[model samples]
Target: MPIDALVYLSMTVFSLPIAGIRMFKISSLSLSIGMSAIAAAALTACGGSDDGAASTREVALEFVAVAGHTPVQCGTLVSGLGTGSAPAQVKDLRFYISNVALLQANGTETPLTLSANDNWNLTAGANQITLIDLENATGACSNGTPATNAVIRGTVPAGNYVGIKLTMGVPFALNHTLYSDVTTAKPPLDIGAMAWSWQSGRKFTKIELTDPEGATGSWTAKTFAVHLGSTGCVGNPATGETVQCKAPNRMEARLTSFNPDQQKIALDVQALVAGNDVTKNLGGAAGCMSGGTDPECAGVFRAMAIDWKADGTGTGLPIAAGASQTIFRPIAR
Candidate 1:
């Protein structure tokens, strides 16, 4: 029953002369039952007010993977693509994306930590982050890593927030081998795997393109896997930690705070795989395969930013907020 209905019902049940009573104090059971009858309506009327108790808001962060589709997985869905019958399947694909950062309205950063066993908790506000999930994800790689991406939602006091900040993998500080004491001290969980080996450093992701010439045919049966991690990693002889090299491979994805009431933010993998990261700081082959000389792959690894445009569903990507996108197509720039 709604609050209005309950209120009406209570008055109707005891209608008549009883209305002369000064204070009609409600009993425990009556109060409980009456409140229960119309809780949702009451809350709606309250509209998350800060009267006796402060009202909390819940935030929903979803991930979508857009590849063959327009807007991928609403914008952050984890997935892989291929088409075939067993050996004919074009599943020879791999990539690395790490070091998550929140894109505030003004364009600041709220970096997060990712690794095998990371501390950044989705429920807690810790900078911990994880991937959503990939279809047919298996092997040691898929063992402990989260199959679901981190969600930062809760009853936060209603206020103005530009957006969130996070990263994809572990940083140099946490990359120190000394940090991995597997004795009585529990090994700190590192959320960025596939990019990290023990504690080398964050290597965002690896993009592999197979079918050399075309689909499963025409092209050679070779594979080109693009892996981005701190190269030239040297292990500390004493504590057994890997020190950071001068430069490391990385990727940066930025998205303005998606205004729930206004425009929705969308991420498209089709454009991403086909987009160009030609900025001086951002390098990568416009049409090159991975696996060659360090220099050959360096240029292709430079541009590692996934920039979502204003037109998510129409002009840019077809990704949505509630669902994720999964695709398997032969796409290129």
Candidate 2:
């Protein structure tokens, strides 16, 4: 029942027997009690004081794979357009996005409260971060597990969010711990395909592509893995601990005009490897393994707006200064 109605009912019920008393006394007492009840009802209706608990609005961080302009899925073969462009099937697509914040019009960051669901996201401090699992173990993604997490759900202050800011890697504190030993480790870190090691840390972004040029549904296909993570770290793989990394490789994605409700962030696979030849293997492990020496790392890192050199590790310059503008784009309406 509404508080106002309840208050009125209570006042009437309590004053019924007292109605036979002196008229002025009953009126004065009723007036006093009625005023108090109305005041309490008004406070209850407004949900307490203004600063007690503000209403929260939900923001969804959605993920999708695209080749050129066509939407692609895990098992679908997407064709490229460049000289070495070849039809390739996505084997796995997963990444970690943390410390999500909403940009205010006055240049302030309001941290989002990530909904803690064991599958896709976990509690990181008071806030929440998400492990975006775009594909599961099917078709070319057979090596992966059968858990698809393509959306991140979280709550922010109810208002107009002008922009979105998120980190593309696990925080350093949570990054260095070993999932094997950690009893409370959650998804993304717990998933064997996503977690690399303590030295390398978690694969911040794992994008695996297989060339489907002449073969279909064959396991004997050449695969390329873009395993972006912390490299050049002094750590013990056995203990699952790392002191620090020479190259953090944590890419920051800032969308200046993204409204999480009205639009979604698109991680374009075509644009990410637009300059590379997905058909030909670059020797060793096929593609960039987040190594500084790997020739393929430069283009891939550059695509995400990271200033990476051929030998690995950035030039100590700011990432967004010379980063490529091809990889992360907003989804069309």
Candidate 3:
């Protein structure tokens, strides 16, 4: 008989709750069943399992943003731009990146478990993202935030990861929450300057540069701001309602052949603003404002490997192409 059957048979034989009476009632059937139950319990206590639950180990990954070889800073003049444009001084550079993952050698991606950093990261429940702030309003960058965040940290599965992958904007559901209404809104999202008044959404990437030499002749420092965000947003911001976006201009960055332990991921601003005119502003906006018809975006979006004018609609969401390369690259630490 089975162990369970022995337990049932012993229950019948033992008339009272006396311990010795139950022991005396043990027959061959009872011994086999009772021993089987005890053996199973021992196995459970010993942590014996056929499933591979203990294989994954905790891993930490760090992300960094840079300009050329140097770390990005305010008031620093960056030269070599599009069509002989003048040297530009960076005023501010803040952006949001989300959905971090580690690309394995077998072409499988392991999603990271993000721990929120009070200064740099924001995580409320399932939503976790990084706010990279690189300047303050001390010198020429008077409009920038003083709190700088260059390094973003997250935990991943311990293994030989071939690459790192991340998305460059807030998800559509959490993108349009108004600052005033959202008490939980953190740092970069809470900043008023990053909020778009027309669309009521956060700027995915804000890179502001000014020419220090007065070469533009109009202002002492002509502005070149690339505010990447969703356009054609429809809804109200006052009631903490998330608006529907026509374009969720979120760019995906995938750096292949990257080892987080040995290599550092670089977000080169030089490659970002490459082949883009800083001095000229053809439209009302000084730089590419994630607008479909903006002439400035043609070069800016192209260099970033984004399909700007897709489907002949003059507008499209940021699509990730495996063949096209982006500014985010892996370099030795």
Candidate 4:
């Protein structure tokens, strides 16, 4: 019952004469106590909160793939992509992200509590990950799946968020696992193309582009691939042991002024390959594979603002400290 109705009923019952109370075989004090108990129970059942606390609000941070100012699609040609201004078709564009946070004006960061789902988002212990799939299984992106996810959905404490921060990789605890193990691997983690079995971890970023002419010069097979993952990994997950990596090539990006409501983060293919000729591969894998000594990785790492060393133990400088990642930037929606 409503509190007002309960109050009125209690007053009416309390005003009853001693004869009415005697008929009920209860004293006036006892009847008053019973009414008070009922009122307390009603209040408890109504979900009333007297304390003032900020409620959480749902946020869907948007993202997009672009080549310079033009939007990127599987079959469509992205012009002005590399140092050679190469026009190529996107073969694959997928990446994993974690540790999403919204920044406050006072420089405080509030973690985005991801909404757990079977497909895109998963939270295991202290790790929260979301896969951002920008390519559909069309044209050159046939290796990818038909489904695509371009937004990171989560909840954050209600406040005026001024910026956004995220890490472009899966967490260590969840990264090193068997991709073929169906019971253990989940949606985003179950993808075979993103798995690196030799390293016992995932390719944090799998970005590939192909020349339309099918040319095979320094760029053999007419494809330039940039696969980012932990390199120089030690230990074996197959033996049920923890894995350690010398260079966890996870890229971190932070936008000091981002409005999630009105802007979307854009990953520019042009910016990623601007420092190198995509048509040429000097050494190592066909393209950059997070190898510290790979000539192709220098340009990619420089674009990502990650310090690179030839010895494979290049986790030295902190790029995120200066917030200098050039591949991802906020654009008006």
Predictions ranked by TM-score, top down?
Answer: 4, 2, 3, 1
Please give the TM-score that candidate 4 achieves against the real structure: 0.82
Tens-digit lDDT string for candidate 3 (1-333): 665665666665544576555444556665666777787777655545334344344555545656667666676666655565456677777888877888887878887776655756777667778787766775567877676776666666546678877787887656777655546566546777778764567888888877776454544228788888877678786675557766666777777788767877777777777766677787747888878777777777775666676233544455554236457888887
Per-residue lDDT value at 123 in model 1:
18
- Pick by lDDT: which candidate is best? 4
RMSD for all candidates, in order, please.
Answer: 12.3, 7.9, 8.8, 8.2
Name the candidate that leads on TM-score. Answer: 4
* Cα shift from native, residue 92, model 3 (Å): 0.6
How far is 121's C-alpha from truth in model 2 (Å)? 0.7
- Residue 99, model 1, lDDT: 44
Q: In candidate 1, residue 175 scores what lDDT?
A: 41
- State the C-alpha lDDT per candidate: 0.36, 0.71, 0.69, 0.81
Give the clashing pairs for model 2.
Answer: 292-311, 292-312
TM-scores of the candidates are 0.46, 0.77, 0.75, 0.82
lDDT of 4 at 5: 50
Residue 325, candidate 3: alpha-carbon lDDT: 44
Query: Which parts of model 1 have CA positions greater than 4 angstroms off?
Result: 1-56, 68-127, 138-157, 162-164, 176-199, 206-209, 212-216, 237-242, 260-267, 275-302, 305-333
Candidate 3's C-alpha runs over 4 A off are 1-67, 214-221, 237-242, 310-312, 322-325
Q: Residue by residue across 13-127, what tens digits does model 4's lDDT show?
A: 3345575355334455666677777766765555432353336668999989998889998988789877888778899999998889999998898999998766888888888
